[model samples]
Target: MAGRHWPGAEPLLPRLSRSANHGVLWFGAAACIATFGGSARARRAALRGVASLAVASATINTVGKGAVRRERPVLDAVPVIRRLKQQPFTTSFPSGHAASAAAFATGVALESKRWGAVVAPVAAAVIASRVYTGVHYPSDVLAGAALGAGAAFALRGVVPTRGQLPAPGRPPTEAPVLPTGQGLVLVVNRESGSATAASALIRDALPLAELVECASADLSGALEDAAERCVALGVCGGDGTINRAAAVAAAHGLPLAVFPGGTLNHFAYDLGIETVRDTAVALASGSAVRVDLGRIRPGPEGPDGPDGCFVNAFSLGVYPELVRTREHWAPRIGGWPAGVLAAFEALRGKSPLEAELQGRRRRLWLVFVGNGMFQRMGPMPGRRHNLADGLLDVRVVHGGRTPGLRLLAAAVAGPLTRSPVHAAVRRRRVRLSGLAPGTPYAYDGEVARSGTELMIDKLPEALTVYCPMTAA
Candidate 1:
């Protein structure tokens, strides 16, 4: 627009060339990305801070440029300011420079008040420089300044009333446990795993309600028998071990609780139930927040595999390797650090598989079709980023150089979202095939046999899991 109106006017290029103005914009973007890297609360705060800047920048640029649509130097309009050129056209209502500077200030504020104070002046100076550069009229800059200040002022900070920092350094105690009581049914995974862990979880959770154990081969029957009594069905095992339990719970409209005892409890972890203790507490007192679950057709498991609903995620491709790695190695190392290391060792020799996105074929080493967000990790796009959101965050990994190692590398360094080879595009339904039985596949963090063909779809708000007050 500026180029068109001010065909001959002082072009925006000369002003943009100066280090101070454009430099600040780059700095602001970096600041936002960095701020978002902090823990959950801080990231949301950072985003809130940037909101005003975005609004102000857009408004200033529009208003100032529109107001000034000044004719360029080459045009016939009398040039009060040096006509960089008569604007090829006219009227500049909002000053983009001013808007850009103001938006930059808003981003700076998210860092801290002190930094906010420093950036504010720099932004103002940048706006003033636009006028001195002769690309903008004084009025243009003044309007930009007004827009910028309004934005800076608007983005004070977002304060969550209830979750506000308690005493400066202390984590707020869990919300006063309400008289939270629900009819819980315990279902154990009699599959091949440390029965002790599931047993311990079952025993610990027994005080909560009814208990029953079902053999992996007959999980469906066991679940059907126990579903009637459960208001919340607590499953004890790896994700697959409890798949039937979840199916029953969903069928009966009951909330489900998980005891993550498997080697790779990705679904459990994604559910924010990383530890036995976390899941236990959630079972005991957490508030239920409804979330989406996915149902896989032509079941990912074997022939006897009961038609099931998954609470965490479902996938094909390199998912098997991830499950195997997490299962085999996580136990030895313990917790996240160990789980990650285990993944590294597992990926060392795996081959990536080829797949397609909307029919465009590509090679994928790891694919995680996810339902929930990993705390501290930003949202998995296209899905509400909420477990309760009825859509799935289907992720596709174009396993790079060393497929396995890439998984391990990305895990420690960061997710592979930006990896040149890693790409994710959302879909309502996905068909996965070309893998044999005994080959790995996962649904809710449990490894199931990948077979002839697998179809996965978002179950749409099918779960009711406990959540913190704020999360609710």
Candidate 2:
């Protein structure tokens, strides 16, 4: 064993080794951190750490120890008390404790640099303790550490760590088009993430602006009333809330101000208004831009053919079920995990949708339409720089094969925005027919039952909104 000469530290190291037996204690601690942190980032880091440890353990126990077939060090020189419970029956070429420690630390670091930094010292201690307990050699711990780190790096290709999503690059100019906070009505969703803090921040930043806080049930009416009162309607919520606010703002001919106050503020980030402070700066400088919104004309379900609007994207088929599952699990398990779980559940044994694409009948797994041009090439599609391009980024997954196989292709294919499995094009208008009556659709994170036939159109420069002047 590596540390037999250092008898003075044997007692502490042995006890620490016992506590980490099978890495159960460490996993439990990580779960606690994730559960208590109360944020999606923390939860994701915890889950990734657990996954890393599992990979490391499996590799070391199954492959490393088995392949090497090295024997554990004899305990003749080890302390009597320490030797009793610290004996590891597995081969000694690579230490499992060291592997788990390195794997978890590296995995967490990949997710959050700050949390990773905090865990690094603890992981180092655990790795050192393995050798100190006289069960493994120093070289064994080093080799295990190398293997664990390598595994974490390799897994990065499959799992996403960062919570901050990418947005469009900044445009070239900085021009102000709207005045500071004057005639602005800011409506905040009280139930959204950090709502109280965001509301306070917004009020402090834009003192001249009128502020309203409303529950989700009353959101539509509150938005309608707020739109009637201000020159520019400011919305502080998630994508769904922003979508509704956009519809009201467009109807009332009001420019919109987006303040990021909800979980996953995709639209606000794309507009270069990542925080309440950013919105404040943009409003103070009178910065604004014009973006396109997608208009969905009602089909057979509606008697009057009323128009519906979405600010982000719209999709039918598997996505609607996935969204529902994600929303149901998000509150308990956090966002990213919920999304992953939902994708699997929705894709399992799912049937393709039968619809007419431009009058041609086809079997489709999903039909996606973006408000404007979106980055269509990666695992996650992004926002467009030319928001007023008057083109809808339409993508469809044809049912040429099983739904599972098509989804797998999408996952493996890099830059799916242009993949063959993903039939994509930019169009001003797209008509989808042959949908069953009351088929659920997801638009901007909100689910609704729509009519069989749907007419989706890109209204060019239809929405003028407050944004950072240099936003892409």
Candidate lDDT (C-alpha), each: 0.55, 0.77
Residues 278-342, model 2: lDDT tens digits: 67777777666778889888776543645888888889889999999999998899877999999
lDDT of 1 by residue, 1-472 (tens): 2223344435443444264443456455446644443222233334544565566756654554565556432223434443333232334545656765665566555544444575576566666555544556666667766776677556554422112323111122232232223466667775635445556645654454666766777777777777766556677676676566667777787667666665455555444454455655655565455666787776445456556567666766665565667666654665456566655665666666665444556667766666544322212222123565455566655656676555444454344445564554456677766545555676766666655556777776665655433333
TM-scores of the candidates are 0.49, 0.71
- How many Å off is the CA of 255 in candidate 2? 6.2
Model 1, stretches more than 4 Å misplaced? Answer: 1-183, 188-208, 213-221, 229-231, 258-287, 299-308, 325-345, 372-385, 408-419, 433-439, 466-471
With candidate 2 superimposed using the best TM-score fit, by how many Å does residue 71's alpha carbon deviate from the native?
5.3
- Stretches of candidate 2 off by over 4 Å are 1-40, 47-86, 150-167, 170-185, 191-211, 227-233, 249-291, 299-306, 318-354, 372-393, 397-428, 434-440, 449-452, 460-472
**Candidate 1 Cα deviation (angstroms), residue 60:** 43
